[model samples]
Target: MNILILGSEEDIHAAHLKKSLTEKGITVDYLDTRLFPTKLKITWQAITHTGCLIFPDGRKWDLADINKIFWRTFGGVNVPKLTDSYQERIAVNDSMGLLRSFMRSQPEKWVNSWEAYEFHKEKPLQLSLANKIGVTIPATIITNNADEILEFSQAFKDVIFKPVYGGSHTQFLTKEHLEINRMKLALSISPVTIQEFIPGTNIRSYVIGEKVYSAEIRSSSLDFREDKRAKLIYLETPEDMKKQCLAITKAFGLKWTGIDWRFKPNGDFFFLEANFSPMFLHFERETGCPITEELIQLLTS
Candidate 1:
């Protein structure tokens, strides 16, 4: 069987998946969206969608006949503008819209289709669904009123705020901005989401197909990702939470997911967030688990 992995050059997970698929004797192809072409044609079924993709080299691929697509981060494409003009940048912006049209046209196997994954991206929706599934989630508030913020802070005392739509972590400026404004969250254009910080240990639960692996993250700081300068402790979670992780992923219609949970001093658990696509190497590094191998098995199955 043939499998197509769609992501950017910088996607470590896709690369890991490639290696695992090769070892499992499956034909694998990489299509970096940034390398996608500016003018493409695809005739699937009785319909056709024609558009252009500003590929890395101005090259295009006719993508109507592809079998399976593993969609990843959209902004992964980094094609430098030839003219550095506003019009040129606008063209690049339009390329993603066209790409979305084609990606949804065919009824093929998608590793958690964009449509399915997008629903979980909304922080409010995720928590709502998590609550319905008997999962314990931290009390959350999404609002612009300063009074609301103060009220939440008073009630929770220690609250952590984050952007509803997150940006790339590789960028230093984005990280600094998030950390700097962790208090006010006033300048935010969109509604800010704040949760009562659950005290205790942090865990990243990875669900790949039916298998579940939990990695405990211990940091002496407020946010682990914030202070990388701090020490980190990683370990596998207990059996009960492992099952809950799987249940959370299934509840969200995700074939694969990374769930963050915090355990309080009183033995209570709080669901932080469910990441549609999260880093896997950290889990592998902390625990000697074969995450990539499991992904390859699911793809070929």
Candidate 2:
């Protein structure tokens, strides 16, 4: 089976995955989206729904022959440095649209299809589904009104804010931060997701098909990503939690995912969110997990 990986050349995770797949004697096609239009071309037939992905090296692949696609990153198409700003924006938009259509044409071949990722990327929707599945979730609110946010914060006493959609980092809203940024909040145009702060050990569980590998993250910073002293230690996931993680994976139709949970001092785990295209190279390196191997197996199976 031939596998296509969508990501930037600079992405370490993508590079490692491609290397692993190649080492296994599998055919791999790496598409750096940033090089779209300039170094890549798609000759798509509307009627037959078939196409050839042309590379800059005079090579091509028939879309129908591609068995699997691993969408690690949907990087923006590169626009010329010196060009009309308006025209550059238009070109970027058009290129992205064309790429989206190409991926949608063969939705079934993706590890986590764009459709599924779009649905699962909404924090509120994912949290609701997780709560319905018997997973414990923290008290949360999504609002654009400053008054509503103030009320929620007052009720929770200590609240953290994150982007309603994925990608943006999470931050704890301290009294000082809120006081200083109160005026800016009122002028905000988009709604924000705020949740009650849950104190505990951060646990990241990676679900690859039926296998679940977990790690405990220890850090002093509220957002572990920015923590300089962060450490990862592999751990065996509890049986009940594993079932919930599997259920979540199935619910989102995800073949692989990284689920975040906070193990509270009270001995209960609070579901945070799941990332469709999570960075696993760091986790694998730290814990020696066979994540990349399992991913290759899943793709080639």
Candidate 3:
């Protein structure tokens, strides 16, 4: 069986996965989305139900021969430098749309299908599903209304705000932030997600199939992603939490995922969010977890 990795060449995680899979004597193909339609060629025939992908290096892969795909990241395709920015934007959108449709057509072949990732990536949807599955979640409000936000803030002494989409960092809503951005809030055009601050040790659980590798993260920053001083230590997965994680993975139709939770002093756990394509190099490097090996097994299995 052959595996295809859909991500950028510069991605370290992708590089690790490819190297490991290759070392196992598995046939692997790499496709960088950013070079689509320019350095790569895709041919498909609806009547024959056949498709072919030609890589930039002149390697050819038949769709039927590819047993699995690792959809890591779908970066923007490179477009010819154009004087008209709108045209370039249109070209990018068209390329993405075409690729998405093709991937969705073969959802069963993806590690975590593109359709599942798209559906679960929505924070509100995932939170609702988590709550239904008996996972504790912090009180969250997604809104653009200034009055509503002010009222919501009254319920919690501390709250954190983040973008509804494409936000990599989290920030606390301090008095200074409120006062300085009061005008901007009043005129806000986009909605933001605000959640009551839950204080505790951060736990990152990397779930691949039935295996779970967890790490307890201690960080001084509000968002651990920005905390360079953070430390990681592997923790044995709790029986109940392990079941819940598996349930969540199945619910999202994901074969692999990274789940983040906050463990309160009282031993209560609060669900933060699920990462479809999580960065696992840090955890593996710090704790020596066999994440990449597990990922390869999941794909090949």
Candidate 4:
């Protein structure tokens, strides 16, 4: 069987996956998206329902021949530089439109389909879907207006905020954050997700098909990822939790996912968010979870 990898060698996770596939004697194709529609070419024909990936170095791949794909990252396509502004706009539209079509076309081949990956970017929608499925989510408000955010701040004793589309680390929504000029400029540009901060242990559950593996993340920092010394402890997956995770994964039309939870000392946990492209080598090494094995099985099955 042949598998295609979208990310480049610089991404350690993608590198490891490619190496493992090679060791197992699987033919793997590399398609570094950073070079697309510029340094490389993609051709698809509706009549034949086939295409080819043409590399500058003369390597080629038939789309029909690839059995599966590991879309680690959609590392954006770089448009070729052009002196004419209008030409640049046309180039951008053409490249993006074609790439979007290519990505969404072969739904069965992608590990987690493009639809799932795109929906994961809409945090508010994610929460709503999970909530409808009986998952308890943190009390939250999404807004771009500074006044609305300031008003929401009054309701909670402890509040935290993070970018809706995700880039920066989570932080406390203090008075300094509401200072007029800074927030007005930023909020006017993009919205943020303000949530009632839940003081609980962080738990990460990985769901591959119907199987679940969970880890307890112990850290002193508000955001455990910022803490260099955070610890990961393996946890047995309760039967009910396993079913819930699988439901969430299916609800998002995903083959696999990483679901984060806030586990309270009182034995209750709140769903935080589900990640479409969660890094897992560290989780595997620390928890002794056979995530990669399951991933390979899923891809090659």
- What TM-score quantifies how close candidate 4 is to the native fold? 0.94
Identify the superior model by TM-score, candidate 2 or candidate 4.
Answer: 4
Per-residue lDDT tens digits for candidate 1, residues 1-301, read 6667777557887887777777777766666665543323322333444432333444444453344666656543344576768876776666655556666664346777776667866878888888988888888887766667666666755667777766622111123433436634644556667777677977777788888877667676666686565433555566777778888877787788888888777777788778877778767765777777777766767
Stretches of model 1 off by over 4 angstroms after superposition: 39-67, 76-98, 106-108, 168-188, 229-236
TM-score of each predicted structure versus truth? 0.78, 0.90, 0.92, 0.94
Residue-wise lDDT of candidate 2 within 1-301, one digit each (tens)? 7889998557889889988899989899787777888888877788998987888898889999899999898776776654688888888888888888888888889988988778776779989998998888999888777767777888976799888985678888777646627635642767788899998899999999899999999998888998877999998998988999999998877889999999987778989998999999889999999999899888988
> Which structure is stronger by lDDT: 2 or 3?
2
Please report the TM-score between candidate 1 and the true structure: 0.78
RMSD of each: 5.4, 2.4, 2.1, 1.6
User: What clash count goes with each model?
Assistant: 5, 0, 0, 0
Candidate 3 on 1-301: residue-level lDDT in tens?
7998888668988888888889999988677877886898777777887787888989888888899999787775777777999998898788777666667768888988977778766888888898998888999988777667777888998999887775669888877656637736643767778899998889999899999989899899888879889999888987777888898888878889999998888878888888898999989999999998899888988
Clashing pairs in 3: none
Candidate 4's displacement at residue 219, Å, is 0.4
Runs in model 2 deviating more than 4 A are 79-94, 166-169, 180-189
| Poorly placed runs, candidate 4 (over 4 Å) | 179-185
lDDT for each candidate structure:
0.67, 0.86, 0.84, 0.88
For candidate 2, the clash count comes to 0
| Global lDDT of model 2 | 0.86
Q: Residue-wise lDDT of candidate 4 within 1-301, one digit each (tens)?
A: 8898888888898888888888899988677878888788898887887777887798887888889988888877899789998999898888888877777779999988889888998889999999999988999999898988888899989999998988888999888998989899989898899999998899999998778999999999999989999999999976767778998999988898999999888877889899998899999999999988888888888
